[model samples]
Target chain A: MTDRPLDPAVLTPDQARALFRAGLSVPTAGWCAGRTQANLIAVPREHAYDFLLFAQRNPKPCPVLDVTEPGAVSTRVFAGDLRTDLPAYVVYEHGEPVAEVADATEYWRDDLVAFLIGCSFTFENALLGAGVPVRHIEQGRNVPMYRTSRPCRRAGAIGGPLVVSMRPIPAEQVADAVRVTARYPSVHGAPVHVGDPSELGIADLDAPDFGDPVDVRLGEVPVFWACGVTPQAAVMASRPKFAIGHAPGHMAITDARDCDYIVP
Target chain B: MTDRPLDPAVLTPDQARALFRAGLSVPTAGWCAGRTQANLIAVPREHAYDFLLFAQRNPKPCPVLDVTEPGAVSTRVFAGDLRTDLPAYVVYEHGEPVAEVADATEYWRDDLVAFLIGCSFTFENALLGAGVPVRHIEQGRNVPMYRTSRPCRRAGAIGGPLVVSMRPIPAEQVADAVRVTARYPSVHGAPVHVGDPSELGIADLDAPDFGDPVDVRLGEVPVFWACGVTPQAAVMASRPKFAIGHAPGHMAITDARDCDYIVP
Candidate 1:
């Protein structure tokens, strides 16, 4: 067996699929550098409308890239085979994580529809290239995420509190951060709240509901952007009978480039 | 009773509602200048997901501005009471136009949801302001719309051929027409096709599927953009038990400005 790390530059979207098919890479984030990667979530067809409506209501946190037809695995917008393209998958039953697997071919059902949602990694690269520091990346830690007091707009059976990711920015560089990220609205565009964590019901800076807590020094303010995890939280709260999503950091990489999502 | 024509410039979104409430303006198009005017459609709650998915599938034609809570009359994003704010509404039953009512108050149900979609009039004004002559406006007729051979991708039970509106532009001005309209993606951004009508299965310029046909003069090519009427066509073809939409030329004016829809 070849033990070399997968080179994203050398792989095609199809080759990436082959790698995932072989159980090579477990997390899909750093695998395909320039291509768009999506956060995948599959739910039973009975709850498809409710999940879709939930995504629409909370667009900032869940900008839907494409939703596949019921019982169909291929999506027209995001090119890739949903069954084997992703390197990892997480199956949830009654909102609780049951298993982590490489391929969902066995768990897949005829009544399941997949949803591809925009991921912040696409825009984060843009920010880094533009000289904006992504603190979590610099510290080699997962971005801190918190459950906010602010509730997402309810739609049918889907309703829950908003989940936000926090990044500390120097006072002088705050505007630059906003300008860089604002261009990609499809990936949780612009910061929802800039200054106060207290306003979001996050009392202690060190304690986060998910991910690692980063340092916020003297001159930095805790800037918050809606996180992709909001939908997962909503799904968990709604407690749908069956759902599947990417394991925390793993995602489905698409043929689309990050620049394609930029507005103007 | 005062018989003065409604002056959009002087009215607030609430005042406009009061005026519409008092039966002062039957057609909402010219009443609220500068504010975003929307295409209103109400569907039974059971059919809400299909219609919403249809809108998502055909966004250029059905650019959704906001969707109201189920059974709720007021829109959280657009503003005011949907029941009496609109000057007029057309009720359709079993795919046929049943009544043109001044108010949907009586027909309003606890299981219905209102959807506000982007209207092309928002961008038409910008085009005219930029010196692009709109043919139908000059001739005092409705803008010409045609049914195309191109089919929209299906979602749930909604699927049908695309419908587009044609505006004749001088060959030299096509680029300017594109740049100006492309700024407003929410309101059918950019042209779907240009130059040849026959390519879209349009046989004669004189006959159109909906609205009046306009003349295309020498050195001008008919530019086509997805029309807001596409959803209505799908609804009719699908034959939902009941549906409601604004009468053509009549729209729902909102608190949002035309510039608000522009991404740049």
Candidate 2:
């Protein structure tokens, strides 16, 4: 752990997946520095349309990168198999997580459809490139997230509150942060709210709904962007009979460049 | 008739829709100046998933703006009814046009799902705003379009060749045309091809497959853009048992402003 760089200069995307496949269930953050990582969700074919529509309707929360064909384990960008490539997966049944597994091969079903959603890692890289300090990365912690009062636009059987990830930026640097992230819409583009925590029904900055809270320094404002974990919230609220997702902070690394998602 | 401004400075979106609803069958191109106009496609809900997937897969050819809920005639942005809003519709039965109707109410089924796709008219506005001459508009004719050799990525049962609309631009203004239209990805972004007809397998510039040809003056280059009408090609090739689409050049005008589609 001491030898590993906080941000690796460069690494092969396959190397990360290979380690995960060999049962090294470590968090994939800080590895494969310039590549795109993604959140994974697998639902039955019956609910696939609704999930796709849900992501389309609320793109800020669920900017989809690739959707695997129904019952198929292959994806467009990643050579890794969806069923067992990730380090960990959380299985959900009727809205509750039933188990966390290193590989979901045993739980795989022919009726399942998988989706790879854009992870905030891409935009965080953009922000970092612009010299904006991501407090979580600086402090070596997960980005703090909160469930907002704003309801996501509904799609068929899927709808829930929007979840947002927060990063504190120096007052003068907030605009630059927004401008940089805005370029990457496929990876949770632009901030949803800036300045107020209560507006999102968030209270007590130190206590976040998910992830460890990084300290907000004086002269800094907490900025919120729609989170990639939102689909998990939607899955929970909708209480689909069966679902599978990568455990939070444990994501699937793909063979895509982070800069490929930049719009302008 | 002489008093009516063909380019009405201020026509309410509803007024034009009312005309279409009241048995007035006419092209909508010049009627709504500042609003977003879209191409319409309706298919049975049974095949809607495949169609939606196909559009997502081939976005340059089919940039979907809004999709109606299954069995519903209303859309999110368009004020007019899908069944009667557009002045005319071409009903397709197993891939070929069976009838051109003033209204599709009689053809509408409970299982029908409608999608509104971005029309190139939006980017044409951007180009015109940037002082890039559009030869077809100046000549008062349809923009020339051709089916290209490039095949659209298949989704489910839908797959076909890419269809592109062409506009001849003064060679000197070609960069400005590209720069302006690049802002509007929803309306097929920048030109797919810039100088050569042979590159796209088009035998002659004067012989367009779909629309009336306009003159390409000397020192001008033909610019090709991904056409919204490509979905009709896919619908025809896939030969779904039933489908409905707007007649070529007849579009559904929506309440959204055209500039709203600008990506930057």
Please tell me which predicted candidate would have the highest DockQ against the true structure: 2
Interface RMSD of each: 1.9, 1.6
lDDT of 1 by residue, A37-146 (tens): 78888999788877887887788888888888888887875666787778778788888878878888888888998888887777777877878777886775667889
Per-prediction TM-score: 0.86, 0.95
Question: What CAPRI class is candidate 2?
Answer: acceptable
Weakest 10 consecutive residues, lDDT, candidate 1 chain B?
B1-10
Q: Which residue pairs show backbone clashes in model 1?
A: none
Model 1: residues >4 Å from true position, as ranges? A1-6, A78-84, A105-107, A135-143, A166-173, A203-208, A212-222, B1-6, B15-30, B78-84, B104-110, B128-142, B168-173, B203-208, B212-221
In model 2, how large is the Cα lDDT of residue A154?
A: 90
> By summed lDDT, which 10 consecutive residues of candidate 2 chain A come out lowest?
A1-10
